[model samples]
Target chain A: MEQLVSALLIMIIGVLACAAYFYASNWLLDVLFPSKNKPADIVAKNIHITNTVRPWLFIGPALIALTFYLIYPVIESIRLSFLGRAGEEFVGFDNYAWLFSSDTFYQSFKNNMLWLIVVPTASTFFGLIIATMTDKIWWGNIAKSLIFMPMAISFIGASVIWKFIYDFRSGDDAQIGLLNAIVVFFGGEPQAWITVPFWNNLFLMIILIWIQTGFAMVILSAALRGIPSETIEAAVLDGANSIQIFFKIMVPQIWGTIAVVWTTITILVLKVFDIVLAMTNGQWGTQVLANEMFDWMFRGGGDFGRGAVVAIVIMVLVIPIMVWNIKDVNKEMEGR
Target chain B: MMAVSSSRSSLMWVVHITVFILVVMWTVPTAGLFISSIRDKDQLSVSGWWTALSVSEQRLVARSEHPDKQVFSSDGRYEIRGNILEHQDSSITKFGSSSLRPDEFDVGVVAQLKGGKTLQVLENGDYIYSSPEQWKGKRGKRIFYTANIPPRFTLDNYREVLTSEGLAKSFINSLAVTIPATIIPILMAAFAAYALAWMKFPGRALIIAAVVGLLVVPLQMSLIPLLKTYNLIGEFFGVGSKGYIGIWLAHTGFGLPLAIYLLRNYIAGLPGEIIESARVDGANDFEIFSKIILPLSFPALASFAIFQFLWVWNDLLIAMVFLGNNEEQLVLTGRLRELLGSRGGNWEILTASAFVTIIIPLCVFFGLQRYLVRGLLSGSVK
Candidate 1:
């Protein structure tokens, strides 16, 4: 209770402080250059000066935060990749050599690749299918909401939920988990789904697919709605079947949205950590790059060099997407 | 035409059935978690939550009254009578005197014991033990029974987690981290977004492009370097490296790119006349932004608020890095991860904790789904 009270106090103070900064800074600017009751030329100069400086005042805090937290970190992480464990000595490329030869890094890279290929494609596929199907049904909104419901669940919570489903028991005891029960009912032996070598990565991917499919669905559904009805009518009149109309006309038109969803989920897959950490914890060949980087960061009293190398690996993977995003935004800005 | 119509109707039915199956597949996992959270812990461990509404059978053992309590009856037999269920809401379907054959005799059927004693069990859990003379033993007989237990639900799991497992405290911590983290970014991003959108500034296009580029930079790139920086600052200031203030700033920084981008797009799209006319009325840029743009951009502000709230609330990696794992500062996700490690097999604790962690976000998602969906549509497609 006391902690909660302090937290509330901190929240109120922090917010008030932010409000005070903006208000105080603006007030100071107006006080320093009073445009009213001055010569016309002086007034014009004061207004121009305020206009020039006011924009800086507005953007100052945000710029400091971004540079300190994000931009600086990217640069520092690169420099640290060349240093030693404690970052005291400069060991050139030793961490990179260790990362390249390490079998676990290869395993994590392989698994991350699998995730990159599977999660986005599967999520986009399911999302497009559900969006198209739900658009036709009367109860589609409810179905859409139900499917999207998992998006609210944290990765740890989702891990717990999936872990329960994948639980296993030896001997003749009843199979309490849903998956094992089904397997047992089908006269098959129950297997620990998350412990299997290659198959376990797929099992881990399923959780992400489940959470992200709804995102794909919502975006694609809107894109589908944006498609002109005349195209679909044209296809129907020309004797194209429903599947043909969907694949030929609708899918082709909404291809850009599909790519967007795919890239978004792909970027998310590159940063996947909590799910892997909670379930299997890089054990059983389920290691991914993000989790691997996290393990290196704090493993055995921390190794900043190796950790930065892994982060650089993740950053390298994301460069293409970053460039693509900047180009897309530039185009949009140009159009505007 | 008639054949095509018939086939079209059939296809529609196929779509409905497929969608129905997909919905059930998506919803059942969460529904199962909720059901298991409320189920009796013993039953929850023994049976799947899908069978929560059905009668479950279990092998259980109970002791009869001491033989010394046997007394002479009107039928000329020493007898002992009692209910083996001890007021439990279950019925015995079968019973035996030995562990080897626990369900040896059907309910209401008499089974012969050693020394010419007999025992009869009834479905309602009543048992009668009788002998030709007096039964002799230092302790009561061990009677094993197979019980048919009805479905049971309770709030005990939730109560236990809330009170004992430190979830209540973590819930408060999550709120503390989330509220400030959500609000600070919105304020900072809104100011910057307004400047970029309305106010003419040097290098505005460059800053906008930087924000866009930062949007997809993997957060893994930021963790280690930031940790070192925070440690340095902590040493310099004589404060701990990890705390709510550190985490709130981290979340605000990470969330700012999307917040600025979304808000900038919305604010830029506002009719230019509002700001122009206000400027012509001799209002300063600050007054124009505070009075006109802020009110007009409520929808955009709302969307970003929901996004940041959910992201901060659901984040575990950021919390694990920026905040300490001690009980005083652990947020719900961190707490849930700890519980997963410490009590992996204890579903009672896990389901309840997981539910507690997700309930708030679920409520927020459902309650503000309109803004959430709107935000996603604009953020992604545009």
Candidate 2:
């Protein structure tokens, strides 16, 4: 309790310090410039100085934090990838060589590719289906909220929930897990679902798909609603069936939002760590890039070089999406 | 047209059925977790939560009172009589004397024992033992029975986990990390977002593009480097490398891009006239930001707050890297992962702890779902 109190106090102080910086620095800028009281030429010069300096003052703290936390780390990680385990001595391409030759890296890379292909496509497909179905129902909001509830659950929490579903019992013991119970009910052999080698990767991906489908649903639902009504009406008048209207008219219009949702879930699938860490921990052939990177960072003492190499793999995969996002934003800015 | 109308009606039925199935599919897993958390641990382990309301048969054992409590009846026979279940509300269905065949006899049957002894069991869990000579033993006979136990539910699992599993402390730790991490980023990002939005800056477009690019930079890229830097800073400051302050700062830095991006879009959309007139009224940029723009941008701030709050609260990777895994600093997710590793089979502990971990976010998700959905739409669709 005392610790909590002290932490809260520190938080308040930190927030207050941030507020004071913004306030005091802006005040200091005005005092230094004296834009209102100076002679005409001097006033113009001071105004220009304040305008140029004030924007920096507003952005300075954020810039410093971003550079320290993000930009510098990206550069440092590249450098660390070239160094040895302790990161003190340079090892050139040794880390990359080991990474390329290791079976685990290949396994992780393959699993990551599989996840990238399956999770986003599955989530977006389900999201579009649910969005279309729920739009016509009166209780649609309630259904959407229920489906979306998993979005709030942490990946680890979702893992626990799904683990319970995939639980297995050997012999004649009653199958307490829902999946095995259904399997037994259908007169089939109940298998330990997550320990099934190559197939277990799909089980892990299901957890992510379950959590992310709601995000896709919410975004795609909004996009579906934003579709102009006249096009659908015109399709109906032209003897286009409901499915035809959905495919030919509505889908093409919201293709942009669908791509957005797809990429968003794709990025998420790349960074998925907690689910694999909690559920399988890269065991049972469920290894992925993010969890593998984490494993190397602390597996035996620490391997900075190997960890950074794996991180760079994930970063390389994200560059395309990153470039695409920047282009999208640049286009938006130009429009503005 | 008439045939199309009929087909459409049938399609509506299909939609309703499909939606119903989907909703159940999505909700049952969480609902199962909740139900299992409240169920009796014994029943929860042996049976699915779907059978939580049904009578579950269990094999149980009881011993009669010690032979010292035996009495000589009027018929000149020694007997020991007792209720096996004591005060439980279960009925015995079968009884036996050995572990190999625990259901060897019917509830009302009499089984003859060696040396002129007899035993009889009843459905009400009452058993009788009689001997022609005397029952001379320190312990009574063991009676095994299959009882039909009705469904039971309790808060004992929750109580045990909250008090014994260190979750209560981790809950506080999570709040400590989350609340400030949520607030500080919003405060810093609001200023940066405003400058990028309303203020005429030379590099605004370039910075906006950078924020967008950084949004997708995998956190894996930052963990190793940041860990080294944090250790150095901690050495210089003479504090541990992992602490609440370090984690709060890390979360703030990580969450700033999205906060800035979301808030910039929203703040940039505010009417030019409002800010122009405010500026024309001699209101300084700080004054305008704190007074007019801040209050007006409440929705955007709220949207970002919920996002950051959920992100920081649910985060395990950042917490694991920045805060370390010491008990004093473990967040709920980390604690839960540990519980999963240690008590992999103890569903009672896992379910209850998971419920405790997820309940707060569930409440926030339901209560402020409007803002969350709006945030998602703006963050992605825009």
Candidate 3:
């Protein structure tokens, strides 16, 4: 009975909210985006004052959220990095020295390098190949949907699925792990997959590749579709073969789209944590900068100082790429 | 007659073939998973799901009734009858004791039973006992019969995983995270996007740049710092950091930059003339945004919402960092991860949970699928 009443009340609130939004939106449109008729000077003065206040109402939440969430934490991180757990004892360079001098930090840095180098490139390359192939075809939409399915899956979700594929177990007499099962069927010895230090990283890389390849495919495919048919025809008529036309004409035309996909995946690769966490939990040298930072801050034996340094280092790498991405996007906008 | 067109067409076919292969390669594992998830657990454990169409061979023992249950009749016949399934080798038609001798036994075999009674069994479970005359004892001894049970399909796995496994609860928790996370950003991004898109303001460029800067700063970097800020702020407000609000705010923080970026581009692509005319007609910025910008920018709003919704819904790290690991507070992705580690062998639960997790994202994606394909910047381009 109580549940029924609350349901009723909730519905009433929802209806009321919608009605208010509707009426307010109508009034708002009438005021802010009135018909193109020129207004009187007196009315214009009021409109200008309201307009000044209006943008704040529009953007105010973002500012508040950003200040508290992004900006404040950033400042606090810097400060906390200089302090100990109590956040009172100031140990300025100790955090920096500890992170830099430690083997864990070096390993994390190396993993980050591998991630930065491999994920984006592999993803983009596969995306381009698929894009070029799937530009216009009978089954193109279906094909695209298949590839793009992983993007719908979350990072954690992808990690879980991949774990089964990479499921490793000890002892031959025990249950056959998935990967080992396949290998042994082919008359190969059961390898301790994750225990193989260097190759295990590649095994880890496959998950990211599986996920990002779809994203790259979609964006790059769109770009490929956007390329003008006339340009391709002209290139072919000018004595170019398929490969040459692809490399020369198609590449130049779709560079903008390629840039968009490359940067997007690059940004994603830098923040990667779940795959490593889910698969190996950063054990056996799979830990990257983000996971390491997480380790430093959240775990029981956490170091505030080291966590902050890693955070700052990640920021340093990302900001420049982002700036470049924005500039490219803005330039593309201006060119249009 | 059409050599040039024919060759060109062939080239297109070549491209089509290549694309088709890539798509098939991509979908194989998911298909395998889908097949494995639905099959019987016993079958799933033993063989790859790809073999679901084929019949499976299993072995079991058919045992005769116990010696104590048999009795001699007046006509010199012994009788023993009961559920034969309990017997170790009751009514054996063909019997190979061990898996190493899988092919040794043949059908319609005669084996000598205790007390010199001869029992003949057919390939089927039908057993014939030759006795002297009238049967004595209550019933025949229990015999075990073995048959190749054909492949069985069921929804029981889904039921078990969804109800007993707490998947329904996790599904709800996922929605709780996703809906708010999606809505908050879209609502905020709509306003911010309109302002950046149309409304001229001081420090707009800087904020937009800052947003772009935030985009690149790797969420891993901010996750810790952000958690610290939340704990401190929570202490002041006396609100626990381990609640829905903290994680929502965290997701909101993470989702904002991309939301703002995607949305601003879309809103900016709307007809400037309409906005300008509205401004000239004495309308305020908020009014213009709420009515014109929001409606026209729906497609972009939708696309960005899908992206944000999916990201937050699927998010495990931020949820782990902010939301407590307790079952009630745990997000679907986090719960799924925990389940994967603990019940890695349970394909049914895993797939059903996976399907449930995807339901929202898929709905959001398909609901706004058109926008997903749209490059809102096409307007700016034109």
Candidate 4:
């Protein structure tokens, strides 16, 4: 309780301090210029000076934060990837060599590739299908909300939920887990889902897909709504069936939104960590790049070189999607 | 029209059935967790939550009253009469006097016992034992029964987790981290977004492009370098590297690009006449921003607030890196992950803790769903 009180105090003070900086800086600018009582010539000069200075004032804090947090780190991480474990000695290409030979790294790379292939495609497909289906029903909004609900759950929490479902109990004791119970009811042997090699990665991917499908659905649902009714009506007049209209008239127009959803999920998959950390901590062949990087960070009391390499690996995987996103935004800006 | 109507009905039915199945599949997992969290812990491990409303068959053993409680009837017979479920709350479906055959006798039937004694067990748990001789024993006879127990629910699991598991403290920590992290980014990003949208600057286009590009740079790239920098700065300042302030700044920095991009797009599309009129009225840029633009951009501000709030509240990796794992600073997600490790098999604790961790976000998601969907549509669908 004392901690909670202190936390609230800190929050209030921090917020107030931020507001004060903006307010105080603006006030100081006004005081220094004092355009209220000056002559017309001096007032015009003051206004021009403030206009030039104010834009920087507005953008200065954001710029400082971005450079300090993101830009500097990207450069530093690249440099650190070439350094030794303690970062006191210079090493060239050795960490990459080690990464290539390590079995766990290989497994992580393989599993991440599987995730990259499966999660985005599955999420986007399910999202598009559900969005299209729900748009026609009366309780569409409720159904959409139910399916979208998983987005609010944290990855760790989702892991616990899925882990419970995949729980395996041995012997004649009735299966407590939902999956095992169904398997037992059908006279099949229950398996430990997360411990299975090669296939466990897909089981882990299912959690992410469950959580992200809603994001795709929400975006695509809007895009689906944005399609012009005239196209559908024209298709109808030509005696096009529902499937034909949906595939030919509707999907082709929403391809851009689909690409956006797919790329977004792909980027997210590259940074997947908490689910793996909570579920298996990369044990039993379920290792992914993000969790592997995290393990290297704390393994044997921290190894910055190997960890930075893994981070760079993740960044490399994400660069294509990042480039694609920037180009899409630039195109939109040009159109605007 | 007639043919179209006929086929459309069939299509609609198919849509309804398919959607219903999908909805059930999606909702049942969460519903199972929720139901299991409130259930009797013993019952939870034995049955699925879908059967939570039905009667569950359980094997139980009950001891009858001690032989000392026997009474002498006027007919000179020693008898013992008592309820088999004296303190329990279940109906007996079958009863037996032996362990091997627990359900040997049907309820309300008399069973012949040793030495010509008779025992009767009833559905309501009442039992009678009579013999034509004095009863002398220290303990009563053990009776085995098969019971059809009704569904039971309790708030004890929630209480246990909240009181003993430290989730309540973590809940506050999450709020502390989330509120400032959510608010600071909005303030910083709104100003930058306003400048990018309305002001004339030489490098405005480049800055806008940078913000969009940074939107997808994997956060993994930032963690290592930032950790080193933070350690150095903390050592120089003689303070710990992990604290609420550091995390708030980290989240603000990470969240800024999206916040700025989303808010910039919204602000730039606003009618230019409002700012122009304010300018013509001799108001300066600051005046126009706080007074005119801020009020006009409430919807955008609200939408971004919900997104940032949810993201920060749901984040675990950032918390683990930037904040300490002690009780004073562990956020809900961190606490939950710890619980997953320490209390892995105890679903009673796990379910309740997981439910507590997610309940706030679920509420926020349902409550502000309009703004959330609107934000997603504008932020990505463009």
lDDT of each model, Cα atoms only? 0.93, 0.92, 0.70, 0.91
- Model 1 docking category: high
Prediction RMSDs, each to the true structure: 2.0, 1.8, 5.4, 3.0
lDDT of 3 at A53: 66
Candidate 3 ranges beyond 4 A from true positions = A1-48, A168-182, A326-336, B1-16, B59-104, B107-147, B375-382
DockQ of 1: 0.88
Candidate 1 local lDDT, B156-221, one digit each (tens): 999999989999999999999999999999999999999999888889999999999999888999
Off by over 4 Å in 2: A30-47, B133-140
Q: Residue A6 error for model 1, in Å?
A: 2.4
Query: What lDDT does candidate 2 reach at residue A34?
Result: 83
Checking candidate 1 for backbone clashes, the offending pairs are: none
lDDT for each residue of candidate 3 in B310-359, tens digit (9 for 90 to 100) = 77888888888888887666678888888878887676678666666666
Q: What is the CA-based DockQ of model 2?
A: 0.79
Better of 2 and 3 by lDDT: 2
Q: Give the TM-score ranking, best first.
A: 2, 1, 4, 3
Instruction: Give me the overall lDDT of model 1.
Output: 0.93
Predicted candidate 4 versus true structure: per-residue lDDT over B74-180, tens digit per residue: 87778899998743678998999899888999999999877888889988899888888888878998889988889999999999999899889889999999999
Higher-TM-score candidate among 1 and 4?
A: 1
lDDT of 1 at B7: 94
Please list the residue runs of candidate 1 whose C-alpha ends up more than 4 Å from where it truly belongs after superposition.
Answer: B65-81, B115-118, B128-141
Question: Which scores better on lDDT, 1 or 4?
Answer: 1
Indicate the docking level reached by candidate 2. Answer: medium
- Each prediction's TM-score against the native? 0.97, 0.97, 0.84, 0.93
Q: For residues A84-198, write the lDDT of model 2, one tens digit per residue.
A: 9999999999999999999999999999999999999999999999999999999999999999999999988999999999999998889999999999999999999999998
Off by over 4 Å in 4: A334-336, B1-4, B61-87, B94-144
